[model samples]
Target: MTPLLEIALLNIRPGQTEEFEAAFAQAQPLISGMKGYVRHELRRCLEDDHRYALLVWWETLEDHTVGFRGSAQYQEWRALLHHFYDPFPTVEHFVGVLP
Candidate 1:
């Protein structure tokens, strides 16, 4: 099966970018340590400093939707980073269609 890509478009609260980054730094290990996690990256938007994109590769859809989200660690992850959003991000999953 093809690997799943999870993408989250994040819009941070004004003046909270630095704090959000720091919180995310602390939260990163929580997801990285989960089952079936392949890799992930968090990137800041060039046009908008308060915007970010989080991309994560998982071995399968369940690896994220079930494995990570169902784990107790998810709560910690939420606590660390959830408050930074002005509006919550929209998360979606994708599959690669080409090389």
Candidate 2:
């Protein structure tokens, strides 16, 4: 089966980019250690410093939706990172259609 890509568009609270990055550093290990996790990245938007994109690759959709979200680590992940958002991000999953 094709790998799943999870994307989250994050808009952090104004002036909290540095703190959020630091918190995310602490939170990274939580997601990285979960079952079915392949890899992930966090990128800041060029035009908007408060905006970010979080991309995570998993072996399967359930690996993220069920396995990770249901794990204890998710709670920690939320605690570390969730408050930074001005509004919660929208998360979506995708699969390669070509190449």
Identify the leading candidate in terms of lDDT: 2
Q: Candidate 2, residues 55-74: lDDT per residue as tens digits?
A: 99999999999999999999
lDDT of the structure predicted as candidate 1: 0.93
Residue lDDT tens for model 1, 1-99: 767899999999999999999999999999999998999999999999999999999998998998899989999999999999879889999998997
Q: In terms of TM-score, which candidate is strongest?
A: 2
Clashes of each: 0, 0
How far is 45's C-alpha from truth in model 1 (Å)?
Answer: 0.5
**lDDT of all predictions:** 0.93, 0.94
What's the C-alpha lDDT at position 66 in model 2? 95
Model 2: colliding residue pairs: none
